[model samples]
Target: MKDTGWIAATEFVRHPSMVGSAFPASARMVRRMLAPLDWSNIKTLVEYGPGSGRFTFEMLRRMRPDAQLIAIETSQAFVAKLREQCDDPRLVVVEGSARDVRRHIAAETCGRADCILTGLPFSTLGDAEADIIMHETALALKPTAVLAAYQMRTAIGPLIDRNFAQVRRDFEWCNIPPCHLYWATGPFKAPKTARLHLISSR
Candidate 1:
């Protein structure tokens, strides 16, 4: 893959348009975000909004050859572009929104996802839409699954806190705009739930 060319194309890729360039996450960033996932415990991994196969490629590089990778994307052009770049047997590129993750992976009794990586432009989504995505995310994850998302907006931390347990800020200086990474596990529990209520719903 011509890494330089791919990054350049992200500038004009259409579909769910955003100001930030598609600028795929760097190898270092991918490693850092996925560092918490125990490789030995993972079998099926899902990448939400894998634009241009940046993080997808990194996942391919790290996982075992037999591990299944399901990439859910909304852009047809990006889906096509990603298909062209990804020819690995372990990877499965599905052209659709992250909201459809449950439907796509439901048939596989053995394909329970252990980790979910999201790059959706959450800041642009309305509360309802974001809620649906979060709801689906919770359903798609296993009992101990982890959700790692990148938000360019610092104020989006509360949104993450609402849907996830053990929510914590992970990274913010990796990208050009310095994204804030939100890391959480499964769903919020009792103690955290009460604390969650204490947080101002700004």
Candidate 2:
């Protein structure tokens, strides 16, 4: 079997639109993206395009024991590799497009995700496709949930801004090519039944 790096490189060569980046995210990049998360309170987590499981491993290590992680990957090779490498019951690797996140989440879990992390390169994706994925992601997340993503280019920043009520930007230069991190919340309306006091308390 080929190693993860080799597999990732091959996948990128074959499907540049899908893979996006030339390399998987560095450990430092993954750490920075996850730094603001409250692992103890996260019950359901969703990951889009978890190529080679770099960030997946870090997320699993830090998340609560009883928490569940749903990794949605369109590449069969990457999906198979993740299943083989990770044996944790908390993980469920699904082979599908990020645009259909809502369906996958509904089939795999009962609750809306507490957070959605992505490595999807909107720069490589067509505007329509990226819009659908972003819209679906917004719908899949709980009202207070977050969306975190890292990209080598800032072309996707405007699209993210349109989808979320608030956006925070950060950068990490330790990675090979460096990347910009975007943290976003809301733009999705809260349930009518949701109490203002409870929402304000969190």
Candidate 3:
């Protein structure tokens, strides 16, 4: 999509809770966070809080031509901007809360998602809400579906661990606050590791 960085930054100031970061994630950071996914196997991708299509367009570029992407955003301004800027037949920008992702995913793909990309700030959310999103997200996805996410805080790791069995922790130091990144799968199963912290640097 066109450069929506400035628009994204402005939105963050107006809606910090919803936008999560002041800057649209660095291209490098987004690349590292998404590199683990096997793009060939991803037919249905769901993105939680795709602010201004940074990750949305990238995923679209990498996913199969016939695949679909459903992006759930709470901010109407962000949603409008995405809808206005992107015309790819593979993209679906929904103006709604990430908490209701299951409904959105079901409507778009009519099945469980192959992957879910999280961009929401769990640290800023209520305990109950964060727990619900994680649990429901696990249920909305295939048992072995991937949950690739990036956060400016580490608190979300344990919450994700509760629902996903295999969790791998990593970090990218090139972003706004030098955030934490995670790749989790094997939903609704016992976690093999409490936390595997690779903790890499830029």
Q: How do all models score by TM-score?
A: 0.81, 0.91, 0.89
Residue 138, candidate 3: alpha-carbon lDDT? 84
User: Is candidate 2 or 3 superior in lDDT?
Assistant: 2
| lDDT of each residue in 27-92, candidate 1, tens digit only | 667777777667677678888888777688877778876688889877666677778876898788
Ranking by TM-score: 2, 3, 1
| Top-down lDDT ranking | 2, 3, 1
Q: What is the lDDT of residue 167 in candidate 3?
A: 87
lDDT of 2: 0.87
Best by lDDT: 2
Model 2 Cα lDDT, one tens digit per residue, 1-202: 6789988999999999879876889888988899998888899999999999999999999999899999999889899899999999999999999988889999988979999999898888988888778878888999889999998889778777767789999998988678999999885543222345577889
Candidate 3, lDDT over the whole model? 0.85
Model 1 lDDT, residue 19, Cα: 21
Error of 2 at 4 (Å): 0.3
lDDT at position 127, candidate 2: 80
- Span of 10 residues, lowest total lDDT, candidate 2: 187-196
lDDT for residue 24 in candidate 3, whole number 0-100: 80
TM-score of candidate 2 against the unseen true structure? 0.91
